[model samples]
Target: MALLLQLFFAHKVTALSILADMYKKRLIEDKEVVIASIVGMFPMGVRVVVLLLAPVAISVLGLKLGIIYVLLEVLSKFMVALIGVFLDRKYLAGGVLEYITNVSLKNSMLDAFKQFFKVLSILVPSIFLAMLLIDLSFNSLVSQISIETAHLLIVVTGTTSTIAGLGVAGSLIATNEVDGKSALLLLMIASALHRIVESLRFSMPVNISLFGSFGVRLTLILLLMNELASIFAILGLFLIINFGFV
Candidate 1:
């Protein structure tokens, strides 16, 4: 239940901090707690919402490509999370199973909610600042970008900085630089390459601050999982494109 809530309300650092707290408190006795968190922190639904609202995603990609993008993200995240769950099972101690077996469903739900919100305070400030940054300068940021690697820039720049990629892709589409299917494929690759640099800034410091050396390892694991998911998505995209299903 904790993992389910985390998956739905994913804020990576916040989720990790909460998990780290649970570990410290011994509320969770699993050595693969990190994996458990990863399984639930994919942000699939959140990204779909973002895609729907973001001007860049809508204007450049259009409805079809936008839907494709959402599908890819959802599928990739789901696949990766499922894999993490399976891997976690290998390391799970009997205690968690026993705890689950003994606990009432109502109590389990309540505890999951409590654990999930333990780091809400940490997330709120960051959310506000990020929204502020986007409101103040997102248009300007997107407007100034004129680059060929728009897709790559999108992923590398992280979610907040996608305005730049939006501008670049929008321009490219306007000028007939790439067709919709082609652009979709390019963007697909970029999406798969995502959070590369942004993860360092947002993920590294927060994880390290909360979990110390363990946080470092955790951050690395998170990055690996993201890349792995991206690879899986890109490969799927390739197959789809090659098969004329684009």
Candidate 2:
């Protein structure tokens, strides 16, 4: 396993290096390209870790439910990636620049946004996958989660990821000339405030049926059914291999 992991990491590093060169050739113009490259690899590392722990994550769903969870995980990641791409184009490049400039954000803030999007393209999927598992753990109807809380989670998680991504990007942008601690502190503060806001939102919908109770329960059933189908798919894959049908 260790050797396999090392080999997997080696490929990731090689890929990162290749991507760095590609950026250097096309987009990256600063001296901080190397730092950007290193930080850029963080999401790759995160994905690898998640895959390695797939068994544990699956355990929560049971073998049957687990397989379904994996598919949902994949679907969620795909959805997030699609959204990230749109975000990257619409906001990361243009909006981020405008937002930073108007707010008088320091240089690191600018660099961070560039880096954050690069990583977010990868991180969003992981987040999406994690959320499905979270739903499974909670087992409540999707509607049971208040709209305020739901929106809050989306905002908090999105903002926090954005800040962290930007910090890494900024560190690379500065090539260590800027203090890492200071940049990190700023990121933390931004994310912390977002969290506080989310907590406040969590309490705003008491005694209010955010969605109809019937719709909420129906959505849960559909989700459960989808999960079961995934388990059968995994079983079919295993059976195919056992029968040498491939």
Candidate 3:
């Protein structure tokens, strides 16, 4: 829910900026840009709504039904995009669909392949190093630290190396007999905020500041999940999974 809200507002803001830029550069008329932004942001807004409803849907209906709803929502967005592209053809001087079908598809595929290799190169080595560290008695070192200190270390490791951090946390959870509440808190922080390094790597190629992405994600994680309330929320989820509601 939090992630969806964040992404939803981000997309709307980005669409507004894009429209302003387009109008300023005379790339499109004001009316056309308004329509285009609305069309583009519709899916993002719907995603927020769908995610907000997911918990209730899953609880009442079932996981399978909830997943089906998400898939249908996504497919509906795709249909809307297709329809918008076709409808806007006249406004775009008639070749937009063809260009998107051929040139854009090729470029997107090439970029996706490049990104896959790039991410794989980083992730594989990180995972190996994480495994190596665990075998070297790193967990023993962490066991000696105070619980608060351990949590801090986990968060730091997560920010630096995602795989290593997860490995360390898993080891601690399994062997240390850590408190369930604390373990859940640490897991939430590590999993959600651990992508700081990956975000930096991707941001650089897109001409975005690494710190900007890192700061935003970190802030959001802390704000949303770093509290007693969040711990209770996790407890609720744990209960739901283990016992279900009567």
Could you tell me every candidate's TM-score relative to the true structure? 0.66, 0.24, 0.39
Q: Write the per-residue lDDT of candidate 2 for residues 164-206, one digit (tens) a residue.
A: 3332323222343223333333333333354344333431221
lDDT of 1 by residue, 83-152 (tens): 8777776766545422221224575456546644543432344334434544465445655675434343
Q: lDDT at 35 for candidate 2? A: 30
The best candidate by lDDT is 1
Clash count, predicted structure 3: 0
| Residue pairs with backbone overlap in model 1 | none
Off by over 4 Å in 2: 1-12, 26-51, 59-61, 84-246
Model 2 residue 241 lDDT? 44
CA lDDT of each candidate?
0.57, 0.36, 0.44
lDDT for each residue of candidate 3 in 39-103, tens digit (9 for 90 to 100)? 45335636443434344334323455344433433444454445445546645553221111112
